[model samples]
Target: MLLDRHRSLLFVVDVQQRLLPAMGGGEGCVARIGLLLEGARILDVPVMASEQYPKGLGPTVPPLRERLGNAPVFEKITFSCARDETIRTAVLGTGRRQLVLCGIEAHVCVLQTALDFAAEGLDVSVVADAVDSRRASSRELALARLRQAGVRVVDSEMVLFEWLERAGTDEFRAVSKLVR
Candidate 1:
């Protein structure tokens, strides 16, 4: 299904300073996520972020934190954001059924969160290129498991374009420049 900007919310999960260095292709993942955030802003999609165990993991990386603007940031120890009451309420409160997720540790937090949201009947999509684990093998396994369970696995570009839905407008122009 095409992503509808009006019906979508971007959920950035645990792209913390301390955790990011452990991710495979971590820098590239952050870059893609940055693109997603920029596109989301241009398209007027609401954004929410999570920091897993912030005391230990530190805050979201400076680049992302700066871009996050006023987006709500939830702190949680739960691997699945859907399992965390506050995060879940904030997400559900948006009334957005389509969730675009990106962040670290694909095999754990990202994977579990996707599964839980999908099971709860949310239309969940994980941006594959924007999420990673310390091991490529683990990321691959997580993506495989997500697909097997019927969560849509997509890339950042797919999300940006889908949200844009057409070309030639100001939103399109701004979002296009982001991926360039």
Candidate 2:
């Protein structure tokens, strides 16, 4: 399944400073997620970013934070973004069932949150290129686990195009610039 503007939300989990270096391909994850955020903005999709233990990991990377603006951003100690009552409440408030998920430590926070969201019956799709762990094996393992749990694995472009749906709208033109 793909993201539908009306039914989905972009969930950017902990892409923190102290944490990113520990995440496999961390730089690439941030870059891909930044692109997703840019596309989401052009498409008018709501976005939520979370920083796990910011006191240590630091804030969401500067570039990403700059792109996010004042969108709903949450800081939590919980590994599962879903476990943070505020984040969960905020998500529930959006009433968006299709979740476009991406972030760091794929085997832990990202995995746990995706599973929890799925357990709540929400359709969770993890951006394959936007998630990572310190170890390549761990990232691969998390992807395997997420897939096993029925979370649809995809990439940032898949998300943009899926939300675009058709090619002629102004939204499509704006998003196409990303691929260009």
Candidate 3:
């Protein structure tokens, strides 16, 4: 299914300072997420973020935190954001059932969160290139698990274009530049 900007919420999970540097290709993952964030902003998609034990992991990385602006950032100790009452409430509060997710530690927080949300009957898509683990094997395994369990494993471009839906407009123009 195509991603509808109005019906979607971009959920960034644990792309924290200390956590990011530990992931393989961490910088590249963050760059891909940056594209998602820019596209989401241009398309007016609602955004929400989560920090897994921020006291330990540190807050969302500076680049992403700046882009988050006034968007809600939930702090949770649960591996699955869906398992955290406050985060779950805030996510449901947006009234958006489709979640576009990007973050670190794919086999842990990202994997668990996608599984939980998918089980709850929400449409969930995890941006593969925008999520990472300390090891490539773990990331791949998590992605395989996610797909087997019915969550869509997508790339950043797929999301941006899906959200854009068409060409020749201002939103498309703005988002397209991000891709380039």
User: How many residue pairs collide in each prediction?
Assistant: 0, 1, 0
lDDT of 1: 0.94
Tell me the tens digit of each residue's lDDT in model 3 across 1-180. 888888999999999998888888999999998889888888899999999999988999999999988989999999999999998888888889899999988999999999998887889999999999999999999999999998999999999999888999999889878888
Between which residue pairs do clashes occur in model 3? none
lDDT, candidates in the order shown = 0.94, 0.90, 0.92
lDDT of 3: 0.92
What order do you get sorting by TM-score, best first? Answer: 1, 3, 2
lDDT of 2 by residue, 53-93 (tens): 89988988888999998798899999998888999989978
Candidate 1 lands at a TM-score of 0.99
TM-score versus the correct structure, for each prediction: 0.99, 0.97, 0.98
List model 1 lDDT by residue over 76-172, tens digit each.
9999999999999999899999999999889999999999998888999999999999999999999999999999999999999999889989998
By lDDT, the best candidate is 1
Candidate with better TM-score, 1 vs 2: 1
Query: lDDT score, residue 9, model 3?
Result: 93
Runs off by more than 4 Å, candidate 2? none
Which pairs clash (backbone N, Cα, C closer than 3 Å) in model 2?
24-133
**Candidates sorted by lDDT, descending order?**
1, 3, 2
